[model samples]
Target: MTKKIENHPIEDVFGDEICEGDTYFVFGNETVLQSNLKQYLIEKQQVQCYEAI
Candidate 1:
Protein backbone atom coordinates (compact mmCIF):
# COMPACT_ATOMS: atom_id res chain seq x y z
CA MET A 1 0.00 0.00 0.00
CA THR A 2 1.23 3.47 -0.89
CA LYS A 3 0.03 7.04 -0.45
CA LYS A 4 1.39 10.02 -2.30
CA ILE A 5 1.22 13.65 -1.20
CA GLU A 6 1.73 15.12 -4.60
CA ASN A 7 0.88 18.53 -6.10
CA HIS A 8 1.23 20.16 -2.72
CA PRO A 9 3.50 22.92 -1.48
CA ILE A 10 6.00 22.55 1.33
CA GLU A 11 3.90 24.57 3.75
CA ASP A 12 0.91 22.32 3.16
CA VAL A 13 3.03 19.26 3.85
CA PHE A 14 4.39 20.38 7.24
CA GLY A 15 2.67 23.47 8.51
CA ASP A 16 -0.09 23.84 11.10
CA GLU A 17 -3.14 21.52 10.83
CA ILE A 18 -1.20 19.30 8.44
CA CYS A 19 1.91 17.74 9.92
CA GLU A 20 1.56 20.28 12.73
CA GLY A 21 4.74 19.11 14.35
CA ASP A 22 3.41 15.55 14.40
CA THR A 23 5.76 12.60 14.35
CA TYR A 24 5.35 10.00 11.60
CA PHE A 25 5.82 6.78 13.44
CA VAL A 26 6.82 3.83 11.31
CA PHE A 27 5.44 0.61 12.70
CA GLY A 28 7.70 -1.86 10.97
CA ASN A 29 11.21 -3.27 10.83
CA GLU A 30 14.30 -1.08 10.67
CA THR A 31 14.61 -1.81 6.98
CA VAL A 32 11.25 -0.17 6.38
CA LEU A 33 12.52 3.27 7.20
CA GLN A 34 15.88 2.71 5.55
CA SER A 35 14.54 1.29 2.30
CA ASN A 36 13.05 4.52 0.98
CA LEU A 37 15.92 6.86 1.73
CA LYS A 38 13.64 8.16 4.49
CA GLN A 39 16.58 9.33 6.55
CA TYR A 40 17.27 11.95 3.98
CA LEU A 41 13.78 13.25 4.65
CA ILE A 42 14.76 14.14 8.18
CA GLU A 43 17.48 16.46 6.95
CA LYS A 44 15.28 17.67 4.14
CA GLN A 45 12.35 18.76 6.32
CA GLN A 46 14.05 19.14 9.70
CA VAL A 47 11.34 17.03 11.33
CA GLN A 48 11.40 13.88 13.41
CA CYS A 49 10.39 10.42 12.16
CA TYR A 50 10.22 7.72 14.77
CA GLU A 51 9.93 4.00 14.22
CA ALA A 52 8.22 1.53 16.53
CA ILE A 53 8.95 -2.15 16.90
Candidate 2:
Protein backbone atom coordinates (compact mmCIF):
# COMPACT_ATOMS: atom_id res chain seq x y z
CA MET A 1 0.00 0.00 0.00
CA THR A 2 3.05 2.22 -0.16
CA LYS A 3 2.66 2.90 3.54
CA LYS A 4 -0.58 4.81 3.03
CA ILE A 5 1.09 7.14 0.53
CA GLU A 6 1.97 10.02 2.82
CA ASN A 7 5.00 11.95 1.50
CA HIS A 8 5.77 9.07 -0.78
CA PRO A 9 7.95 10.88 -3.25
CA ILE A 10 11.54 9.75 -3.71
CA GLU A 11 11.93 7.89 -0.47
CA ASP A 12 14.91 5.96 -1.80
CA VAL A 13 12.58 4.23 -4.16
CA PHE A 14 13.44 0.77 -5.34
CA GLY A 15 10.13 -0.34 -6.73
CA ASP A 16 8.59 2.53 -8.67
CA GLU A 17 10.67 1.73 -11.74
CA ILE A 18 14.41 1.12 -12.02
CA CYS A 19 14.58 -2.14 -13.83
CA GLU A 20 17.12 -2.47 -16.61
CA GLY A 21 17.81 -6.16 -16.73
CA ASP A 22 16.54 -9.50 -17.84
CA THR A 23 17.39 -12.90 -16.42
CA TYR A 24 18.34 -16.32 -17.70
CA PHE A 25 20.36 -18.92 -15.86
CA VAL A 26 21.47 -22.37 -16.83
CA PHE A 27 24.79 -23.57 -15.58
CA GLY A 28 27.35 -25.92 -16.94
CA ASN A 29 30.05 -28.24 -15.74
CA GLU A 30 29.61 -31.99 -15.39
CA THR A 31 29.68 -32.54 -19.10
CA VAL A 32 27.74 -29.40 -19.72
CA LEU A 33 25.32 -30.14 -16.96
CA GLN A 34 24.46 -33.46 -18.46
CA SER A 35 23.99 -31.88 -21.85
CA ASN A 36 21.55 -29.29 -20.65
CA LEU A 37 19.58 -31.88 -18.75
CA LYS A 38 19.10 -33.74 -21.96
CA GLN A 39 17.82 -30.63 -23.64
CA TYR A 40 15.42 -29.88 -20.85
CA LEU A 41 13.98 -33.34 -20.88
CA ILE A 42 13.39 -33.12 -24.62
CA GLU A 43 10.88 -30.31 -24.15
CA LYS A 44 9.69 -28.71 -20.98
CA GLN A 45 7.41 -25.88 -20.08
CA GLN A 46 6.54 -23.40 -17.34
CA VAL A 47 8.51 -20.23 -17.78
CA GLN A 48 7.98 -16.79 -16.34
CA CYS A 49 11.32 -15.78 -14.99
CA TYR A 50 12.81 -12.62 -13.54
CA GLU A 51 15.59 -11.96 -11.11
CA ALA A 52 17.51 -8.98 -9.81
CA ILE A 53 17.59 -9.85 -6.20
Candidate 3:
Protein backbone atom coordinates (compact mmCIF):
# COMPACT_ATOMS: atom_id res chain seq x y z
CA MET A 1 0.00 0.00 0.00
CA THR A 2 1.13 3.55 -0.75
CA LYS A 3 0.78 6.62 1.44
CA LYS A 4 -0.13 10.13 0.30
CA ILE A 5 2.32 12.94 0.81
CA GLU A 6 0.83 16.20 2.00
CA ASN A 7 0.47 18.97 -0.58
CA HIS A 8 2.24 16.89 -3.16
CA PRO A 9 -0.82 16.15 -5.22
CA ILE A 10 -1.07 12.78 -6.91
CA GLU A 11 -2.77 12.55 -10.29
CA ASP A 12 -3.61 10.21 -13.11
CA VAL A 13 -2.66 10.47 -16.77
CA PHE A 14 -5.48 12.96 -17.26
CA GLY A 15 -4.51 15.06 -14.22
CA ASP A 16 -7.40 13.84 -12.06
CA GLU A 17 -6.71 12.86 -8.48
CA ILE A 18 -6.80 9.17 -7.75
CA CYS A 19 -7.90 9.14 -4.14
CA GLU A 20 -7.32 6.49 -1.49
CA GLY A 21 -3.58 6.33 -1.29
CA ASP A 22 -3.74 7.90 -4.74
CA THR A 23 -3.03 4.46 -6.09
CA TYR A 24 -4.30 1.66 -8.27
CA PHE A 25 -3.57 -2.03 -8.82
CA VAL A 26 -3.47 -4.14 -11.95
CA PHE A 27 -2.81 -7.80 -12.62
CA GLY A 28 0.91 -8.21 -12.13
CA ASN A 29 3.58 -10.63 -10.98
CA GLU A 30 5.76 -8.41 -8.87
CA THR A 31 6.72 -9.05 -5.26
CA VAL A 32 5.22 -5.76 -4.09
CA LEU A 33 1.85 -6.43 -5.70
CA GLN A 34 0.17 -7.85 -2.65
CA SER A 35 -3.33 -9.20 -3.33
CA ASN A 36 -4.83 -7.31 -0.43
CA LEU A 37 -3.18 -3.94 -1.02
CA LYS A 38 -6.13 -2.23 -2.71
CA GLN A 39 -8.73 -3.87 -0.48
CA TYR A 40 -6.71 -3.09 2.60
CA LEU A 41 -6.46 0.57 1.69
CA ILE A 42 -10.21 0.86 1.11
CA GLU A 43 -11.96 -1.71 3.28
CA LYS A 44 -9.56 -2.26 6.17
CA GLN A 45 -8.16 1.24 6.46
CA GLN A 46 -11.14 3.04 4.96
CA VAL A 47 -9.41 5.21 2.39
CA GLN A 48 -11.17 6.93 -0.53
CA CYS A 49 -10.02 4.96 -3.56
CA TYR A 50 -10.53 5.58 -7.27
CA GLU A 51 -10.04 3.43 -10.30
CA ALA A 52 -8.06 4.65 -13.32
CA ILE A 53 -9.88 4.17 -16.60
Candidate 4:
Protein backbone atom coordinates (compact mmCIF):
# COMPACT_ATOMS: atom_id res chain seq x y z
CA MET A 1 0.00 0.00 0.00
CA THR A 2 1.12 3.55 -0.77
CA LYS A 3 0.86 6.27 1.81
CA LYS A 4 -0.18 9.82 1.02
CA ILE A 5 2.34 12.56 1.58
CA GLU A 6 1.26 15.88 3.01
CA ASN A 7 2.74 19.17 1.81
CA HIS A 8 2.48 22.61 3.41
CA PRO A 9 1.61 25.71 1.40
CA ILE A 10 4.50 28.07 0.73
CA GLU A 11 2.58 31.06 2.06
CA ASP A 12 1.96 29.16 5.26
CA VAL A 13 5.69 28.80 5.76
CA PHE A 14 6.94 32.07 4.23
CA GLY A 15 4.03 34.27 5.16
CA ASP A 16 2.46 37.17 3.17
CA GLU A 17 5.82 38.89 2.62
CA ILE A 18 6.56 36.24 -0.02
CA CYS A 19 3.78 37.64 -2.19
CA GLU A 20 4.83 41.28 -1.94
CA GLY A 21 7.66 41.47 -4.45
CA ASP A 22 10.10 39.70 -6.72
CA THR A 23 12.84 37.59 -5.10
CA TYR A 24 15.90 36.63 -7.11
CA PHE A 25 19.24 34.94 -6.51
CA VAL A 26 17.93 32.31 -4.13
CA PHE A 27 19.88 29.56 -5.93
CA GLY A 28 23.63 29.14 -6.21
CA ASN A 29 23.60 28.58 -9.98
CA GLU A 30 21.54 31.72 -10.42
CA THR A 31 24.02 33.91 -8.56
CA VAL A 32 25.95 35.05 -11.61
CA LEU A 33 22.78 35.47 -13.59
CA GLN A 34 21.20 37.48 -10.81
CA SER A 35 24.24 39.73 -10.48
CA ASN A 36 24.38 40.42 -14.21
CA LEU A 37 20.67 41.00 -14.36
CA LYS A 38 20.79 43.32 -11.36
CA GLN A 39 23.58 45.33 -12.93
CA TYR A 40 21.79 45.55 -16.23
CA LEU A 41 18.61 46.61 -14.53
CA ILE A 42 20.46 49.24 -12.50
CA GLU A 43 22.06 50.65 -15.63
CA LYS A 44 19.07 50.48 -17.91
CA GLN A 45 16.64 51.74 -15.34
CA GLN A 46 19.15 54.13 -13.81
CA VAL A 47 17.99 53.18 -10.36
CA GLN A 48 19.86 52.51 -7.14
CA CYS A 49 19.87 49.09 -5.50
CA TYR A 50 18.07 50.54 -2.49
CA GLU A 51 15.49 52.00 -4.83
CA ALA A 52 14.03 48.55 -5.25
CA ILE A 53 12.12 49.23 -2.07
lDDT of 1 by residue, 1-53 (tens): 44444432233222323333322323342212233346545765467888899
- lDDT per residue for candidate 3 within 1-53, as digits (tens), equals 56545554344323355454544443342211244466555754589997799
RMSD (CA, Å), candidate 1 to true, equals: 12.2
Largest lDDT belongs to which candidate? 3
The candidate, 3 or 4, that scores higher on lDDT is: 3
lDDT of each prediction vs. the true structure? 0.38, 0.29, 0.47, 0.37
Which portions of model 3 miss their true places by more than 4 Å?
1-33
Residues 1-53 of candidate 4: C-alpha lDDT, one tens digit per residue: 33232431233212222222333233332222232456645755476777554
Model 4 per-residue lDDT at 17: 26
User: Cα lDDT of model 2 overall?
Assistant: 0.29
Count backbone overlaps in model 3: 1
Task: Supply the global lDDT for candidate 1.
Answer: 0.38
**How does each model score on TM-score?**
0.25, 0.17, 0.32, 0.25
Q: Judging by TM-score, tell me the better candidate of 1 and 3.
A: 3
- Kindly give the number of clashing pairs for every candidate: 0, 0, 1, 0
